[model samples]
Target: MSSVLITGASKGIGRAIAIELAGRGHRVIATARRPETLADLPVDQRLRLDVTDQESVDAAIREAGEIDVVVSNAGESVRAPLESVPLDEVARLFELNTLGALRVVQGVLPAMRERGSGRLVFVSSIQGRMVLPMIGPYGATKWALEALAETLAIETGHFGIQVSLVQPGAVSSGGGERAKVHLKDNDPYSALYQELPVLRGEVVTPEAVAATVADTIEQPEPPLRIPAGAPAKQVLEARKVAPEDKPFLAVPLNW
Candidate 1:
């Protein structure tokens, strides 16, 4: 069985991935801010890892000496227009979504390179590719992650390490729930585009995304991008051959 390490495993997609992988007999090293929350899984070696902290990331890597797969699953969400967003919130979003994942990758790559056989999965989003409104910053970070994952795949392919990106269109998670709560706070451009309520229901359960991830992990040659839901699949396919003038919706319907 391959040894796997997944971040943000305390809840949501991260948690489901951990359970799925473990159920398949892979020895999983699950990391979360609150390790105790992972009590439901095989947790003899649960880890406390806040992705934003370099020291915590480094220590977690050190603890998981010979990893076969590393899933960069930690992230946060911030909903607001680009200009109206506070500087700190924007920074936090990137720090958690982009930099945190990068740090984890850097920490694990050395061992993967040494082993000459490893898999790296990035849990990105559909918003990474196309943009709507009130989600530019979030999408920007995912876009950056896409670039990073692609380059890493090329750089690490010769070493027998496979780098892949899994774009879950919209998985219902703690962060999403939190965003829903905040969505009604009345942001800058709320009144201007308030005719979209159907967009609000565009979310798939974490279990759905986890199933695709498990499939990708078992596939012989997984693609660089795997859209996770019907909406994401449609958007990705449409955008693939879409006309330049056509616009694709990337934000929630309520936004």
Candidate 2:
């Protein structure tokens, strides 16, 4: 079994993935900002890692030992229109979601390249491809992450390192509870903001996403990108054929 290291493993998708991989006999190293939060997980190791901090990332990588796979799942989201979102919050979102993933990648790539065999799985989102009201800030970070992951895929192919991007749609995680909403009392998009959750409809379970991650790791040659949930598949497929301006509008908003 492969030795897998996952970030943001205290809860949600990351936590689910850690549990799934461990159950499948993979040696899993789960890291969260607070190591105490991961104390109960049945994984090989629990580490305190804040991806935004390079020193923390490097130390965790070193401690984890030879990682066969690295899942860059540490991320956060903000709900706000581009114009209305606080600049500082937006910056923080980008720092955590976009650059944070990169930090982990930077820490692990050297050893992976030296071994000439490894997997780098990035947990992105369908929002990386399609944007909706109040999701601009979060979507922007995902978009940037997609670009970075895709570029890394190309650059690292020669080293026998595989890169996979796992995109899920409206996951039933605590993301909503943690999201920073920026809605002013008199904001023009107040109505839209109120309608956003309704429009999101049903969400996929975190276990579904974790299963996909495990499957990806098991594959000798997994796809470069995978839409982890049904909603993600529908949205991504629509984005491919639908008009650029209103892609996936016809796919029904139940997703």
Candidate 3:
């Protein structure tokens, strides 16, 4: 089995993946901003890794030693309208959800390049495919992440490095409470906030998402992008069937 490294593994999908992969006998190195949070996991190694900090990322990679697969799952969610969202908050979101993945990718890539084999799996969201009113900020991050992962797939193919984006729909991440809403009681976008949850599909467990990621890793030649749940697949299918000339606004809001 390959040596695997997962970020944001203290809880949620990352935590489930660590458990699943370890159960399958892969050497699992699970890391988070606080290594102490990972004490109960059955993985091979638990190290402190803050993806926002370059030094911390490098240190984790050094300690892990020759990782064969890197699952860049460290990310967060936010809810706000573009008109009222703070610029500083947007920047912080990008720093974690976007650049953080890049830092980890850059850190582990050299060894993979020299050894001529590795995999990079990024945990993206269905929002990357479609956008909701109050979720634009979060969608923006995943959309940008998809672009980077797609580009890396082309650029790193010859080096024997594979990149995949695992996009899951609504997850049971504490009833979506993980996403901090930036709006106030009398906010102008209150209507959107009230209606947002209605547009979501069935909520899947973290274990289901973990199963998809693990299945993707087992593929000798996995596809560049995978929609992990029924909700995720439905979103992608909707996008595919949409008319090219008509605006997204014109399309039915049946989703």
List the pairs of residues colliding in candidate 1: 199-253
Least well predicted 10-residue stretch by lDDT in candidate 1 = 192-201
Judge candidate 2 against the unseen true structure and give its global Cα lDDT, from 0 to 1: 0.89
Q: Per-residue lDDT tens digits of candidate 2, residues 26-71?
A: 9999999999999999999999899999889889998999999999
Residue range 1-255, candidate 1, lDDT tens digits? 778889999889999888888888878999998878887787436888899999999998888768888889988876666666677777888999999999998888887898788999999988778764666777888999999999999999999989888887666775754652124456557753353335433778888888777788888788888888787888778667867786765343543
Instruction: State candidate 1's TM-score.
Output: 0.90
User: Model 1 lDDT vs. the true structure?
Assistant: 0.80
**How do the candidates rank by TM-score, highest first?**
2, 3, 1
Stretches off by above 4 angstroms in model 1 are 180-188, 192-197, 245-247, 250-255
Pick out the ten consecutive residues of candidate 3 with the lowest summed lDDT: 246-255
State which candidate, 2 or 3, has the greater lDDT.
2
Estimate, for each residue in 1-255, the C-alpha lDDT of model 3 and write its tens digit. 989999999999999999999998999999999999999999999999999999999899999997999999998877888999888888888999999999999998888999999999999988777776777878898899999999999999999999999999888866268778889779988776777666666778899999999999999999998999887787788877887785342123533
* lDDT of model 3 at position 66: 79
Candidate order, lDDT descending = 2, 3, 1
